[model samples]
Target: MRSRRAGRTTGPHLRPRLRRHPRPRRSRGTGTRTRTRTRPHTAVLTAVLLLLAGPAGCSGPGARPPADGSAPDAGSRSPSAATGGEDGAGHWRPKPGTPWQWQLSGRVDTSVDVPVYDIDGFENDAETVDRLHADGRKVICYINAGAWEDFRPDRDDFPRAVRGRGNGWPGERWLDIRRTAVLRPLMARRMDMCRDKGFDAVEPDLMDGYLNRTGFPLTARHQLAYNRMLAELAHERGLAVGLKNDLPQIPELVGSFDFAVNEECAEFGECAALTPFVEQDKAVFHAEYALDPDDYCAESERLRLSSLRKKLSLDAWRRPCP
Candidate 1:
């Protein structure tokens, strides 16, 4: 089980490709249905009013991911150094409370009414992105960052030594994040694919490796360094990046990331951990698979988060916090 997103009643963070990790229905074991990931919505999104009137500023060289065993240092390499976003070269930074649509399964549904759309980076091609943009939506590319799935096209690229135990779901394993030197280039290439496809931002899932029971000796610092380097890579490609499901490190990381994507934070009583993004006037894009929008929408509004209700399959249907 990758987590709840990985399987029903289990891990819930990874955004598997077109086909989801299958789980048995009406499980006698847990009295639960199979669960799918409500992928983190991303895009270098801005307010719709501003976006349609102007083009995004995602053009030019930005920052590079730090070398192996390094963290994003304030003095040496901060996200702002490469982005300095007020300038035209940096990518678009989403404003607080930006509206979005997240759909990761079924046929591409472009009919949803939202300014931003987060979809599978590989499953959906450049045409899908162009269609969304023509309809006036910013697109975010979703990729699983911290875990490796056997089904992915790049699965063979990862050496077996770096692959840890399966993460709740079959065919998915937690990666040894300590190997930043190896992951940085792979991740960068993926981010480059997103940029080349015309995506405005990238959402990297399963980023909370430190908190998971992966079969590796990962520390908080290891996670921080790796996550920071991800942000730098996104910025370097002129793509905004969202911090997915890694709530504990929000304070230390909010400045480095462009936005936040979380799952069931409200259900787990951890929504408060995401306020740093809100306080910074950045969008906190959140979703709940099991909770009714009524249960959390009001509080989400108060916190200035763009909260929505999604099924585990993360299809086109969504209930936004009104």
Candidate 2:
């Protein structure tokens, strides 16, 4: 199985010292749902609105919503938009063979000169985004929408009531996605940070948490709602969002997300689930860690996916599909 990091890195003060070890994997087994015990709707609206207001002096051309009250679809014709965002609204439709770089360990390796860069959202700063943009690259902010890490700067903001069983990850727990009144605002703030940092799109991780024993009675509907809210939030911020490895929901979520990012789908024989994105002319950035590059390159090329053989750590070492 391919290993992957499961948490988001926060600010400098909150960033944990990098530990030298194999990447963390999701734990197996079922556990009781442990909801954070708190008032469901407390301080939600005010906090979200306050965050929506751009941070002082950091506003850009697209900072505010358009006067018509309808946000620009990412697929709209905006120079700053991603591939699928040819429409004025911030919709995303990345095409096949899109070049991309994915890094999730330590500090971001911004030196790579790829057209699309996927970096840690909380650890990266506005300057990093600016630098990538200066180099004519589109940046994708990496956020963890499915699990909660104890090291996040906003860790205190998450009431213990919403945290469920541990996600087999150290210091990380599964969140009850059904609690829209709570998770939505938190996720909104994360999205706002991505916007503030000038990311053109977002790649939210741990999206497949619902398939595990999350300790909540979370059904498919709950996951769908949460995922949809995530995409909507990214769109509202004029940022394109990709659907990370939630394969089972591809049929339902393909239209909602601007693109798709998958890990080891070829190994599991589930790559077919991602055909909708390609059929729609949306990019699917796929990666596999366990397979030999030569073995999968031909298949990946046949599918026209921008695939790569990567280490579980997702370092700068990348072998792209031919």
Candidate 3:
């Protein structure tokens, strides 16, 4: 009985031992020992991760990595971008008390050489414009916008349909500004010429044609449309455009122009008309052909106009209001 019990226990124990030690099983279809087996899915995942990591580790040309490895802001990507000023949406309004010189007759006396020049557009050449610019002076191309001057290179370009009564000046006739379709492209070309000549601004003279006997029944709306077109064309070429005279429309047109070049605003008791410009922080360059320097000095000082007295011919002989 004891022998039988020993046999039973030994047999059971040996069977368990044999099962535990049974097979050092080889991998199926290969003579390799079976160990911890990783899945094909795990290998595929590792390969995909490595491929993704390769591109992340590489740097492209002109690209800069953020200091903290965060995504870059929109502005950070473009370092050479301009911030603001004339390149942006800001208007080109020249400051008050800006020194300027005006010469409208004969060959351009580009001799005074101030920070600003009021030069005859028809008489001045591209070289003259460049030389004035090189001297650090802002050039204003003076063009007769209200009247047709016989001396202009484009004198023949004005159609008889647009030309009207004489403007009291010899060889000068008033223009029918109501026809904007014909005049806009002409004036735009003129502004283009000024811009191409390196002029920084345009001084469109005779803007007060509506006030004068222009031979056409020019309403204020017609004048406004024509004037606004001039402003837009000037702005399109990045050039500053000035409002010359046109006292009646100052309140309506002040914002459209960069500066105001008025003739005899003080004489007509219309100095108050130009206050809109001063209030809007725009420069008003006033010149009087009739008034002496001493006569208008105090009034000009009170009104804050860059007032000067000169001959009607507009020579270099400038006499500032005291």
Error of 2 at 294 (Å): 1.6
TM for every model, in the order presented, reads 0.75, 0.74, 0.70
Going through the candidates in the order shown, the clash numbers are 15, 27, 0
Instruction: Indicate the residue-level lDDT of 188 in model 2.
Output: 95
Best by TM-score: 1
Cα lDDT of model 2 by residue, 93-207, tens digit: 5676686777766666666545777888877789988988887778899887877878778788888988998754457778898898998999999999999988899888767
Sliding window of 10 residues with minimal summed lDDT for model 3 = 11-20
Native-referenced Cα lDDT, model 2: 0.65
Instruction: For candidate 3, write residues 2-69 as lDDT tens digits.
Output: 00011122110000001112235433222322111111133433443353332211111222323353
Predictions ranked by lDDT, top down? Answer: 1, 2, 3
Off by over 4 Å in 2: 1-85
Native-to-model Cα distance after best TM-score fit, residue 260 in candidate 1, in Å: 0.2
- Models ranked on TM-score: 1, 2, 3
Determine the backbone clash count of candidate 2: 27
Q: Please report how far candidate 3 places residue 223 from its true position, in Å.
A: 0.9
